[model samples]
Target chain A: MNIKIVKTDGDVEGLAEQKWVYSPSVKTHFFHPENLVEDVNGFDDSDYNGVGAVGSPACGDMMKMWIKVDPKSDKVVDCKWQTFGCASAIASTSMLSVMVTENGGMKVDDALALKPQNILERLGGLPPRKVHCSVLGDKALRKAINEYFRHSKQFDRMVIEGSVMVDPDTRITDRDIEEAVLEGADDMDKLQKKLKVGIANKDAYAKAEALMGKFMEKYYG
Target chain B: MKISSQVNKLLKDHKKHDIYLDHAATTPMDPAVKAAMDPYFCDKFGNPSGFYEIGLRAHEALEEARNKVAKILNCSSREIVFCGSGTESDNLAILGVARFKGKGHIITSSIEHHAVLETIERLEKQGFDITILPVDRDGFVNPKDLDDAIREDTILASIMYANNEIGVIEPIKELATVCRNKGVLFHTDACQAGCSLDLDVKELGVDLMTINGSKIYGPKGVGCLYVKAGIRLEPIVYGGGQERGLRSGTENVPGVIGFAKALTLCQDDKDKENKRLTQLRDKLIKGLITKVPKCFLNGHAVKRLPNNVNITILDVEGEAMGLFLNELGIYASTGSACTSKSLDPSHVITALGLPYEAAHGSMRFTLGHCTTPEDIDFVIEVMPKIVEILRKISPLDLDSNEVQEGHGNLHYK
Candidate 1:
């Protein structure tokens, strides 16, 4: 043990162990993720009431969530997810999945109301730059809850974060335009190709193009 | 007691289940280099600039170390100047020329390290025209491109001998020939090349060269710059006129001695160590690509450094893969967004003009004295299993856009 490591400073000559940089909570959730999604292939959604996907590979992080809701109590019975992201992102989704189902499934509305901060607090804290990774889980959970509301014919209960009704018939919102931009949509033509929002409504389409410009500047600028 | 022979002295038990494969980041000091340095710290504490007997001895040791470096580099002892670190050497080589020239055009490559890139950028902002040539898909600087990029106003060109991230070796001699015919000075950062490549400045035909100690199993904070005679440079640091008035500071006596010893040992064992490391490096690259799906080598297959194996694993992020490998006691580095302070992925991968997504999955494993064939096998055996676990938790379907085929025989569904 008296080899005297060269980089160690004065009064610390015994040995120096390079510690791992993750917190215990983050480490545990990353290694053993909970409620992971399994491919049921042709009819996987049959076991869940709703499914929603968020973010995109273009942004380097994405999340997909599926929830099985019990109609009797209007509560989530099971929640499962998969993330195409980094360590904090995977851990945040795993922690979010466990949070929604730990006490026999949180109420559907409460799960919908959850925030990224709540998940981050439970997992100690993520690296400051990685705080954006946890936000995808909150967005994906809300998207799943919205799907559940639409499936149950209670369209009034559908709540999307930071969205306004951009089109009535096609049901496309400004959030769809934002997501399109996040996926590398730089112009109205690309946005129209992806969402097909401006065909039937010209005036709304023109306004939609303006909104797309704002989003492109916000995300890319 | 510990074993006292050469083999026992050089090798030790990896007691903590740890394997450090990130040699490009920095290397542990060699035991012999440490032994050579110990005297300067405690027993031989004399200022090399002082006029006393103790000072004269320190000065003599410093000159001896400088001569050893100069001999390996095929330059005169007076041409070598010691500086603080590799970055300082780079800054001096670049800013010194820029300052001496007053204002002119400079050229560099896109894949050069920040030490060279940032220096050119700073010069560009000072009303100096600059051109950054692009690399080929496999990360090689085309000499013909340099031939065309040289303008009548071009005063200098700086390039790296070997890239640290992808381990790609540039055609330095051919590129320097182009600059020579164009009547321009050529500088090269050989910081990562000292372990494997030849450092003969005459053979390379380079006017300015930068090399440091940390990457070559020597002490840190000591760097040497080879400046050919008659090429005037404005000194970046102003002080007591040490290092021929180029870098003026109190000499790092211990560090310089250790650096000379390390470089000597590396050059003495270069042929044997390079052969050993090349076999292990190729084994690692081949095994990782053959076993893991949708992965491919990052740099040139044949022209790479002997100890670097960089690859991109599809359907998984680099930092996640690196962190998992760390848990299993395999240490490596990633070019992924999360591994760095910023959200941008590695510039080296992107400079190849490959798919941007490849940068997100890029991981680099640089071999060192401790790497073995068993370590390569251990990684190959464990990588695919780790990929499968992460794929189960991943929603990325590389099947949608772009091409379907991968160099590693990846099949997407």
Candidate 2:
């Protein structure tokens, strides 16, 4: 679905969805033209070939990109993203994800070669300081993808069902979503029992539960 | 009345270690001027207004100092009214004129220091109409704009003699001529221009002018306003009759004496010092241009203060540069002390239509009577290194090799 990413000085076309976004100076968001968050949550492991996130609070921009790859064809079937920054940063990340997916699976070398100007031109040119904003998305996308292959052992079933494969080093154990309205847990004891010997250990479960509580409070409360 | 030796040593250490390049902020008092003030603080510390014999002698000395200041400014002693400082002088002039006239229009430039701008703002709230004239790229307000901005109701037109941030000298005499022809009172905040430029009240045709003692290498907390003969201005501060009933306060005898000495000394070496200062200013500007790439001078090249060299270095943050310069014991200012607390650039720079990057990159360097060639050399040598280190770590992409090529192309062009 085509999405319109409106920035302060310009805009770009992309398939919009949430990943992780950051911008120090100003706030922003991502959504598809269908008036809903893109179906990023439904992608299976084979569909999650690569992802990238860039920018820091110190530098004032953050962008995260997710890619779903077709194993048989070695092609990018779908891509989605989220960003937190001024309007330009959000638009750049959204446009970048669409460009990579539309051109098939972006090779590591090709993604690295993408210039800030390319994203800027696509978004109809940003203000001079904001040119740096585009670079963040490019860097994040390449890093997330490279990380997937570098730690492939961690996620042995790279093409699992109903899970987007993040960097191989990054596995979403059941403990990661223990407090997140788990379709399985009945109460606190069940939650704790599942967490104790879960694929992710107790400490990881505790942290993830805390994060889920915060996410619920922030978005649902 | 002498300060403790420990205090003296502390002050001496401050002077020896900190290379103050903010003379436009305030100057270190000259030894001779300080010595001239010694008598007024100690043995002869009598109230000049007292009727005693010692008081009469002190009164006579005070009159002599006034005459000296009056002489340096090319005005009669009767026209000069000593005030607390430059800000007070500005307030007194604007409020006094607006109050005395009862109701009238006022015209001033957009880049005026808050001393004038805030005073005008206060007057505006109190039913006075004010027109803020615009300035050009070089920070020069057109004389024609002043002419057009004037109205039949205009009672006074106030513009600064030189901008504090950019240091661009305005066409004060030209504007004064227009005001004179229109029969409107003219005031100028000559605080920044006091010691650096000549003062001829008659030639400039100004009805009121502000000068700061601190700006002219004298004592702080004392300044004077020049109100031309027969100009009706009411006193803003009311109390015992003083300053020919224009300003009423117990006179600051020592500060006045020091101010007089500073002005007299400045007048004596005006020409030679102006030339010398221009040389140092030029050398500094040239050094920056040759050493630093992607930098542009902010103010007027030819029509600026003899001692001012303000520039904007692209891709480097001003606050970081300020901190790094402080670490090296070299003192300077981003623009004005008023706006230094905020990480933002000077409004004056922004008003000149500079991009945010250029404005945030600005730095002001002002020399003074005590600034030597050695100081300039040291600054020229050390400044680029600091800028280089800052740009390297800055988020703005400013690699030296690309910048060097750009600089080479600029020179070749």
Candidate 3:
């Protein structure tokens, strides 16, 4: 037997299957994530028709995606993305990009219907605590689809996912809380800084604060 | 799944992970320590509790190992309680003491190992008032803070000698003095500090201390807790009434022998190893800070362990950096939640009051016996490139949020 030091088993390939902690599929996407926009600043957005983003870097997770839609059939032709997130988030986003554009692309509505559960299932599974990461990709995809609807003058198709309006005046919706939470507004004070919902109207502020709690629990719980 | 099996095989076949930088997690057993333990598994297999000749020999060996460890610790042989592992020792020290008292106020730092923190947490559920003192930016638990937190009902203060994550050594003697003045017991988990620091329990003034074998090039699954003479602790384990009735089980004779040998070796070579490891550690820290942009060290500059270098490189995730580093055969650890099952960033890094985001990019490299100057250089040269790649791939706007105010930035102290 070798004396003092044992070599770290050279099983770099085995890092994919972390037994119960991570499945092989989750690791595959993490180690070799697909459609990664290498430089978001330098990305050529001229080819893309729709752009959407969710979460924030300050929250320790953020994702932005761009998709080109085939207007004739409303099919997503190409997708590119970038993220500041963890293994689960990164892997989910990478798989999301593949899901939208593979086999000549998923229809725009079909892509919008995709959920965190689908992503979680595709990745085999994430640890129960890390289920939040799987939500990043689906949320960003929803944002992109909405952006496409707004741009192409299909106002009827633009829908915010199950969100109620926080302030009908400033047009601050409960959706704003998710974005604000993503942008690092963890508490009411930070939320006030970002959305400024409670400054002029006490009623609006109270509504905003309650919504912020709801969103924080939803995103972080 | 463009994850081509061909590509994975090609990558695996070409790489050799010869570097061993994550010593804070565990260390390889020394050959001498292993050789000394070989006979105990077979030839000296008799139970130390038996009355036969072979049993008597085993009993003598057990006492000899105890004396050797106690001599280094500057404590009596009867004070040392051998247990299964560092976690088990921590459980014995904190739970053993707490369960004896039934229920009372307890004080501990936010940076303690889960073995201490979790045990205390469980105690809290049983109706104990718990105070978790916060640390400063460089992860220092102020002695005055410990002094302030002590109460009339405070039974014990269980703080670590050095943190496993950042290698920041706490003010143990000062903290111990506060507990002594307040008539409360003190325990320190010195698992990470044992190899590099002085283990003289008298000088440190700690009432109890825990040390582990896996961290000191001995066999894993063996740890010792120094319980001051005349101090009472209830047994957490119950069986054959080994370890002075404070522990009950058939003793792990080989593990104890290996642990004593490793502790003796550490005592003999500590100064020289510390000097050599310190040079390498500083070089890696300095080199990474120079090579990478907007990165800062996580712990006290001079008061940290000689072998630990924990830094947070801006604009990247630590797990991504770890995978890239692995590709080059360098194994280190990161504080990124992506790498953990809990999905929460390191509580120690978070306790330093770093923005939650700062915890995502933190990487820890703990040097050990197998590490050479060349390994440090290789990391210094390669780590920055990996960070650069991750930063470019990341979606956050570099300017607006790269140095964004608040959260976890500006942690250098």
CAPRI docking class of candidate 1 = acceptable
lDDT of 2 by residue, B168-253 (tens): 99999999999998888999999998776878888888899999999887999998999999998999989887889888888889
TM-scores, in order shown? 0.84, 0.63, 0.85
Model 3: per-residue Cα lDDT over B1-413, one tens digit each = 12334235435654444687889999988889999999999899989999999999999999999999999999999999999999999999998889899889999999999999999999999999999999998889999999999998999999999999999999999999989988999999999987999999999999989999999999999999999998989989998899999788888999999999999998799999999999999999999999998788898988999999999877678877787676666778999876775545788887887765677788999999888887888788777666665665676434324343334332210
Instruction: Put the candidates in TM-score order, highest first.
Output: 3, 1, 2
Tens digit of per-residue lDDT, candidate 1, span B40-134: 99878899999999999999999999999999999999999999889999999999999999999999999988999988998898899999999
The residue pairs that clash in candidate 2, if any, are A21-A83, A21-A84, A22-A62, A22-A84, A23-A84, A23-A85, A47-A68, A76-A105
DockQ of each: 0.24, 0.02, 0.26
Q: Least accurate stretch of 10 residues (summed lDDT) in model 2 chain A?
A: A28-37
Count of steric clashes across candidates, in order: 0, 8, 2
Interface RMSD of 3: 8.6
Identify the CAPRI category of the predicted complex in candidate 2: incorrect
Task: Please give the lDDT score at residue A148 for candidate 3.
Answer: 83
List residue ranges in candidate 1 displaced over 4 A: A1-18, A40-43, A160-221, B1-16, B399-413
